[model samples]
Target: MTDLATPGSAGLLNGKRLLITGVLSDMSIAFQVARIAQEQGAEIVLTSFGRALPITEEMTRLLPAPAPVIRLDVTRPEDLERLPLEVTRHLGALDGIMHSIAYAPPGALGGRFLDTPWQDAATALHVSAFSLQALTASCADVLEDGASVVGLDFDASLAWPGYDWMGVSKAALEAVARYLALYLAERHIRVNLVAAGMIRTVAARAIPNTDHLETIWRNRPPLSWDVSDPTPPARACILLLSDWLSATTGEILHVDGGLHAVMT
Candidate 1:
């Protein structure tokens, strides 16, 4: 939607302030999104917790202009309550927020879908889904009335090899996005998701039977795709965050090489 002719061009997100979470490694999609967002002129503030903070700080150096890292443990009420202050300390106000955080205990994933205890499943939902609501509320005062909120999503309409409880959590996340969109509508804020295809990130490796999962994707995608390439989804995110998609909200933009369209 940006006037820039070439994709990934500069100035698309000019002068915007963005808060990005779940940037734990260089290979993470949030990391690429942050780098591209900064290249497009958005001032980025990345969030990390205890041990991950120093590593995330190290990752920031790789950015075009190193962004400051902030402490935000999504499950912590105190952390969520104080996010606005920390964000304002570095960047005055937020134009967009990208929620890329998700986690499931080992018992909740793998082939233990039914065996996972309620506590684990609940933890999955709280961190992977409910945190979106918590985050939006915590940052509400700073988020502009017309600001955009985007989250990373996996297609949860169907089950996957080892995604297990995380798959259920993603389904909850989809619903969470819809609800957030409705709730934020009156405020002129936009809430949407990018339901991404498989990418070989740290989180992906934890899932069991990834090789089979990759096979299904490789054979299914209408457009050629690389499991290692995150640019497509990252680009979609920046587009949503930019003024280009001001009219769009409560939508799921699938960046999976058109795989979801195929019935087989």
Candidate 2:
């Protein structure tokens, strides 16, 4: 197991203010990123919506410092419109934003690709792909010059057995990041993504045939891939959020233990 550094020991994000979304539980990648960001000296505000709000709120208590949770349902136009004021009320101008949100309904995932209804597929694309644009644009007024935007991603280059509509959504996400990077460049804002290997998160477990995907990662990567631990990808997110990668944008940094490079 790779040892996670003590929070705040590195100070990589010292004095930064960030808005992080998609933290449903401690097991989530966003949770770890928020935890480490606080340890590294960032003041972060988190977002959750509806029934999951309380769950995300509870997870914040486990962070190095408890962060305030704001309600944001990306699919709701009202929520997106109010996001800037809500975020500004908590943390003034943002230095970074973490786009860790994605979802596909039961009807859209788990080998239901051919049988899935158009509504189900559209919902998946709207929530998983277009939400990045919605969230960023909503927060644009509050984003500081040179702010960084990082989104979590699964490799969409090849189809995984049961990934289904979520796979299509991810490909859309990559394209969105590139366009955001191009347009946001005028403000010196950087937009990038981290394509990660499977980790045993609540979200990952929801995808069908995850066991098969995990097995492939375990066997193919040149480097040892731990599906149990999320530290590596969390660290990559922190790096992108920091000033160290000022020149990098519209890029997908793979923290997938070399599985992305090896052909099966």
Candidate 3:
């Protein structure tokens, strides 16, 4: 569902281009962003990895028009090195990047933090936290002067029932966003995060007892909460990426139906 008020020319993202990662299915937050961004006149591309490539290629075929899917497994040096070149080849210079990638090994979640191994912890940090920095640095040269960088986040302020290492990874992700915002200010680039509430995405499915977390939100949020829909958070991301938020950076804009602001 798009707002009809937006013009064909003054599209929220006219002439702007964005690269979105972590789009595995139509229910993905990245998928929502890609759809809306294109509807608003932004050129877009998707990135996938390894055996997941065919899945991404299949998904893109569902879009209104076909868009390129580039290879990017953030931890792989070669993939990161070629990302900018690949995007430029398909979509020209980047005006925005969506760091929607994050992962944690099975052993790292659903237990005491102390039980987590360094290897698993390190994997979480690299994929969930450091990937943001890697994506930004790799594409920095091609990023337009007022480029915006956005990532999907879940609040890491406290421990959760089964989030374990992923909770820690989220904390690191937040810090990385702030540091990037500070450092990239000189380049007229903005870095920010949308700390969205849990939605039933493929990534969220990895978290143990995620449905319990969603059930809790149904009764607690100030505004209505919908665990099934990620469009609200997706739209919020487009706002932060657009020129409308030129002055906003290093901020965590919560799109959790106001849950993060209230206390029981």
Query: Backbone collision count in every prediction?
Result: 0, 1, 0
TM-score for each model: 0.95, 0.96, 0.96
Screening candidate 2 with a backbone cut-off below 3 angstroms (N, C-alpha, C), the clashing residue pairs are: 8-39
Task: Give the residue spans of candidate 2 off by over 4 A.
Answer: 1-10
147-251: candidate 3 lDDT, tens digit per residue: 999999998887888899999999999999999999999988999999998799998998888878988779888899888898999999999989999999999
How many residue-pair clashes does candidate 1 contain?
0
Model 2, global lDDT: 0.92
- The Cα local distance difference test for each model comes to 0.89, 0.92, 0.89
The whole-model C-alpha lDDT of candidate 1 against the native structure comes to 0.89
Between candidates 1 and 2, name the one with more favorable lDDT: 2
lDDT of 2 by residue, 1-264 (tens): 432444555588888999999998777999989988987888999999889999999998899887899999999999999999988799988999999999999999998899999999999999999999999999999999999999999999989888999999999999999999999999999999999998989899999999998898888999999998888999999999999999999999999998888886
Poorest lDDT segment (10 consecutive residues) of candidate 1:
1-10
Error of 2 at 69 (Å): 0.2
Worst 10 residues of 3 by lDDT: 1-10
lDDT of 3: 0.89
Q: Highest lDDT: which candidate?
A: 2
Model 1 stretches astray by more than 4 angstroms: 1-10
